[model samples]
Target: MLIKRVPSAEAPLDLLLEADPSIDTIKRYLESSICHVATIEGETVGAHVIQPIGDGVYELMNIAVAPAYQGKGIGTKLLEHAVNMSRKLGAQRLELGTGTFGYQLAFYQRAGFRVISVERDHFLTHYDEPIYENGIQHKDRLLLALEF
Candidate 1:
């Protein structure tokens, strides 16, 4: 498998949806962003999108791995690649927001992201449909940051 920046993000829209459920939300972050994809034999298995916020800090806008490929280190590879890419672009830190509780929170924490703040009722205010995982509704967004 190989990981590289994708010229067009159109192809992995489906894969990206696997992580962020809303197309509107995806559009907000995807525009003018850098997109990277992991492919195995030319088939896309995962994708990560990044957008520069300011002051050498970038936002990890979106990252998604095919459901079948989750927990198999593909996401990890994508994240590691994202970090390297960030540093190459002279980034001092990377920021991302995720649910208050989920595998995603654990994953980012493991990757060195620390909780910087929380946006209360973010999902409730933004998403039309409620997002639930492990039978628990996600209402807030935990803003995580990793300073390099």
Candidate 2:
């Protein structure tokens, strides 16, 4: 697998959005942000967006791998790239939000993230439609951070 930065506007965004729809708005807002896609055997399988939030802080906007590719460490490699890229860019901390509970939370925890804050009822109130994954709907957002 290879992770590559894709600068074209038409670069398989549907896959990314399918992983996390909230990112569509973020992608629209951050014009100069960097986006990466992971490919295996010439197929786009995963993607993540990184946006600079000023004050030496960067946000991990979206991190997702294809359903069939989850648990195979593709997300981990992308995360490792994000961490190193942020550090190289002089970021003091990296922040992201995820469902209050689930495999994603544990994935970040395993990747050295720590809970920093929580927005109660964020997912339930912020989104117009319910966000569901594998028969589970996310009701809240938990903010996590890792300082480098």
Candidate 3:
């Protein structure tokens, strides 16, 4: 797979967000952040977006892989690409949030991210509609960060 910065409109990212409903937020992030897509066999299979939040830090706004392509390490490649890009852009750290209970937390952990904090009632208090997957509503957001 090859990773590159591509126009969000040009990437097949809808497939990524549909895999996890809360990731729907990614659409808005894509509109304004530095975005990238992963291509395999010339087809977009994954995407990531990074947004600057000042203090020399960037927020990992989104990272998603096509459902059919989830286990092939495409997300990891996309993340590594984002990290390298952040360093190139002179970012001192990267931060992101994910549901308190999900594979996503572990995925970021495996990528060398460490838990920095938690928003105790983020999803429950911030979202108007309960964002759920597999019939479970997400209630908290665990913040994770990595130093560049």
Count clashes in each candidate, considering only residues at least 3 apart in sequence or on different chains. Answer: 0, 0, 0
Measured by TM-score, the strongest candidate is 1
lDDT of 1 by residue, 1-148 (tens): 7988876546388888888889877876777789999998988899999889998999998889998888899999999999989899989999999999978999999999999999999999999999999999999999999999
* Candidate 2 segments exceeding 4 Å error: 22-26, 133-136
TM-score (C-alpha) between model 2 and the true structure = 0.89
lDDT rank, highest first? Answer: 1, 2, 3
List candidate 3 stretches off by more than 4 Å: 9-13, 19-24, 133-135
Task: Give the TM-score of each candidate.
Answer: 0.96, 0.89, 0.87
- Clash pairs detected, candidate 3: none
For each candidate in the order shown, give its overall lDDT on alpha carbons.
Answer: 0.89, 0.83, 0.81
Off by over 4 Å in 1: 8-11
Better of 2 and 3 by lDDT: 2
* lDDT winner between candidates 1 and 2: 1
Per-residue lDDT tens digits for candidate 3, residues 1-148, read 8888877676556765653354456566667788888888988788888888898999888788887898888888889988988888889999988888778878899989999998998988866778876788888899999997
The Cα RMSD of model 2 versus the native structure comes to: 1.9
